[model samples]
Target: MRDPLTVSGPEGPSFWAEHAWLGTHVEPGVVLDTGADGRITAVRTGVAAPPPGAVPLRGLTVPGLANAHSHAFHRALRGTVQTGAGTFWTWREVMYRVAARLTPDTYHALARAAYAEMALAGITAVGEFHYLHHGPDGTPYADPNAMGEALIEAARDAGIRITLLDTVYLHGGLTADGHQPLEGPQIRFGDGSADAWYERWTRLRERADGDRVTVGAAVHSVRAFAERDGYAAFAERTDGVPVHVHLSEQPAENEACLAVHGVTPAALLDRHGFWKPTTTAVHATHLTDDDIRILGASGAGVCMCPTTERDLADGIGPAAALQRAGSPLSLGSDSHAVIDLLEEARAMELDERLRTRTRGHWTAAALLRAASEDGHTALGRPGAGSLEPGAPADFTTVALDTVRTAGPVPGLAAEAVVFAATAADVRDVVVCGRTVVGGGVHRTVPDPAGELARAIAAVTT
Candidate 1:
């Protein structure tokens, strides 16, 4: 039979150790004791072994990774959206039509499968940029938080942590000029006023049992929050929580913002107190110098979705510039075009090389930190993404002995990880000291492809 502990079937934590590494490299005596609340009570990093009875986890210990941004609904559209012509705009027309028909049942099935895949790939947490809010035709449900509950329950079933970045999407575009109305499924998301959306934002429940989920907030964009009241109200409400927004994701958004407010979306967010360390700017392609300055000055985080960016033909983001300006960088599997974390990291650096006149613009260490540490920090989980004392025993172990990464010392394993590792080599994944992935597989009931098929049948047929 398989190892009893292999599938991580809700069994409690025990003792763990091995070649553990955090922001830096691995050290022995790295025994981690996980608490009932999922906090780290003690970390002894000497040659000491667990006293008395013990459980030994003999692999590299590192912080669990956070997918800083995701749109779970889009996971269904992955290969289907690949062959589409036209630009992001044309694809979005098709997306909106699909979004118009989803019920909570469909979202739960789809998200559970997507989150399980994230676990298989060693992503312990995700900040879901969710905005599809109402019934099939943009009408409010009997319970306003029904859609939110579906997402939360999905995370629980997948055995992963989530920060549901509940969103506020108001208008379709600038002053209703050439901008289309909240057409198709857009009506389900709006609350009539930004203040009204703020009221719902405040209703978010911030705690999760077993330390697995949390609620957060997001502003869809400058286009979604056209009114001065809408943006200001949102920022003020989400002051201390994890906040995210789609800022400067597209040049058209910038042009529209300039046409209406005479500023880029980043500048407009700054004016509205939306820029903060707790904030994550998604995509963040097409930045001006001032845009970089504001992002750096605010100390917000950036999530570069290389797969989605390349898939949609969005311009490359200024990752190196954002780093130089003091913004902590992170990665996302936005639109679920690809859920592999290392690919996101590698594509980020490679895209920089493709766009600029320089080579070696970003270090492998930086990419690794962005993948594991920065994202956890940005996710507001203390001591996350590290193997030090007081950090959650959340981690993934990869075999460096593979042919793809045999060229470098294990000291450079993190770099090799970004450059050479694929999801296939991720041998184990742990969340809160609970083994979730073993035999290089995550145990989940719903089939991912089947779930995608169901979603397609619901929306397209």
Candidate 2:
């Protein structure tokens, strides 16, 4: 796959949208000009129509959606895992079975297809929460970072930006007794200790391009690290890079943490100086009041994967409270039961409404920000997710004439998109001034659905 950054000419490209969301409201006849470096150089509104050389984009265009947290391999388990009665813990056993079957080559095929699907859903950037390091049975490949490299290459082939959040997972599971040893397929995820993990991460960072591919670090969860002191040391070593951790996704996890450490997961991490501006906590479903206060005061971000949470029967999170307390919110398609960022955005608001028996906890614009701007920020792309000067030349157009998206007032285009639209409504996608998907079809991946079926069959069957 060719890099979109190098494919543009010196003059770059310009796009004219029939209607565009400018972060706050909808505007008609907007023209966005990009520089050769793939950043927006200028944005003009009130243009009557497409200029002679500008590419014409019909329907409603918005900044590209960001999938702030992802497990690319999980895309294979989508329909296969839905048939059984199970919790997140039970689902893990099945997921591990698939993980044991993957090689660098197979993983590349699967992730490439998965990422192409993300492109079709208007996701321009994905933060891959990757921990599947080494080969099966706890052996390192010729290249220890081979699995991570496969994911980076997959993103390139799929023509989307990626933040490879390489994860450090030391232990298999935490119990009231203590942290357990990594056994079976879980051994592939462990790097022996934080020092070794950091050493590998340092090498991975050296290969990161910092533009389309940013390398980040992650702690698998509070249970993954044994000692509290290790959190502070890991935080210091990974300073400045985006760090993410799974936090209290289940009540069982919180119960075990309190039993072993005598504090909630959030409080335990906060006591060790792990919460920082660069850190983001995923799930955050079972947080206490003090946990919320601690996370909010520390300025860490929260990434909510609404579809996965609902799929796993996790309860609604206090998203509005967290935002009010000063934590930025972002959305992700974790587990990928569905890959629609629009649905993820609306699900967060709708789930909140279901919890409180109230409506309009968040406006459509605010939800869109969670899906785009805040999500990009969480993935270390702060200037992306907006169609403005100096932002990345990434945007997607949703067909206003789609069956579900029709009949909305022009001013309420953002609302219509967030509430009514699905991934099928995405008509075009541009990333780094290159159109990856046009007319609801992917440019490079020829047949994403066929590729996905083949890749998933290779692993699941």
Candidate 3:
């Protein structure tokens, strides 16, 4: 591969070559030559230069990574949740307290900072499982979708693509036989019923073909919507759109689901036809063999929030076995426990090692696929996860010479990316040919860190 020049014209093959040893990943045999639209227009192995008049971009490239699951506002709880006697349940209590407090303005401010952090961490897109709907009184806003719009604009301000998984969270539990009722902040997240919420969900704004956002759906959980048709009804209205759910993150959730529905959360969700290519199950920490099989056969993907799971003592999902079982894997920083894709990917395997006491299970190649390709699938944008031609030019370039990836060739970049690197190692981030993270900073917004602090202050104090 020769050094390529930068393109200035309206059109030309945007030539980018990998002089570093490449990480043969995802479709290991496939190659790509991408246009400005981020679609690969050509395919072949071996490095090829642009056909003249093309602009060259320097740095090692991988497909842009997708954060398949995120609760952007929760990024604020990173340090706040680790206090005394903390567990997922206690964390949930604090989360409700915060949720009970956010105004649409506060959400936009905090979420803008959160999405900016995601972009800086090499996340090209995020599936924001937004459930902080309505106001403190639980009444519909004058605009109905005002809160949703704030989040969308925040993503735009951050310059990262988003699949807003506008969540429908009805009920406090599976039923009176299940958990409790609307307590603290949980009231703000609920919308009455599956059909009523679906009507409001359809009222969401959508992005254009070249737009950087898509409106998706999420059931707070099977525990939140135990009725058989809860998710199915929502999916029907979505018409094959991406749907996400929080499945069995804790044993208590699994126990409750079984006690009420006589089935695992996964089985209950499957019986209703809510598991599919367009579906994403967040956490999915506690699953039965039957649960695993159902997720695999449905062609659904599990988003492993390794850092958050570890932080909250949430059990690990069967990431490797699930993939082998035919379900794809993806990564997320749910709760922003760490908010680093590299750490998220590495923890996927480390947790497996802890469980099976095994040496090797998930490889760099597979984790990259999950972080990039599988994540894009759940984001309602295909091919945005890789660097192949005609694929979305979404990618993040790390400092090869940095301590995180020291002594690494481009081939090992993927491995180094998984095990050692941090968001700090990412030197440049490209999303749809627009630079989001450059020189260790976000271009569109000044003082992102400060903005985040201010936003959090506004919400907390």
TM-score of each: 0.90, 0.99, 0.90
Off by over 4 Å in 3: 1-9, 12-59, 205-211
- Residue 321 error, candidate 3, Å: 1.8
- Candidate 3: residue 192 Cα off by (Å): 1.9
Q: Measured by C-alpha RMSD in angstroms, how accurate is candidate 2?
A: 1.0
Report lDDT (Cα) of residue 294, candidate 2: 96
| Ranked candidates (lDDT, high to low) | 2, 1, 3
Q: What are the per-residue Cα lDDT tens digits for candidate 1 across 1-461?
A: 23211224333365555556656565654666666545556776775666555455554545677898899888777777777477998889778877876788888878878888888788888888989888866677787878888888777677678888888888776642534467667888787777777666666563443246667788887778765555676677777778888888888888888887778888888887778899989888999999999999999999888899888988899999999998999999998888988889888889999889667977777777888888876666645777655676677776566777556765676677778987666767777766777656666534656765776577667
**Full candidate order by TM-score, most accurate first:** 2, 3, 1
State the lDDT of candidate 2 residue by residue for 286-331, as single tens digits.
9989999999999999999999999989889989899988899999
| Stretches of candidate 2 exceeding 4 Å from the true structure | none
Whose lDDT is greatest here? 2
TM-score leader: 2
Deviation from native of the Cα of residue 136 in model 2, angstroms: 0.6
Please identify which of the two predictions, 2 or 3, would achieve the higher lDDT against the true structure: 2
Candidate 2 clash figure, as a count: 0
Model 2 has an lDDT value of 0.92
Each candidate's clash count: 2, 0, 20
lDDT string for model 3 (287-313, tens) is 888888899898888888988888888
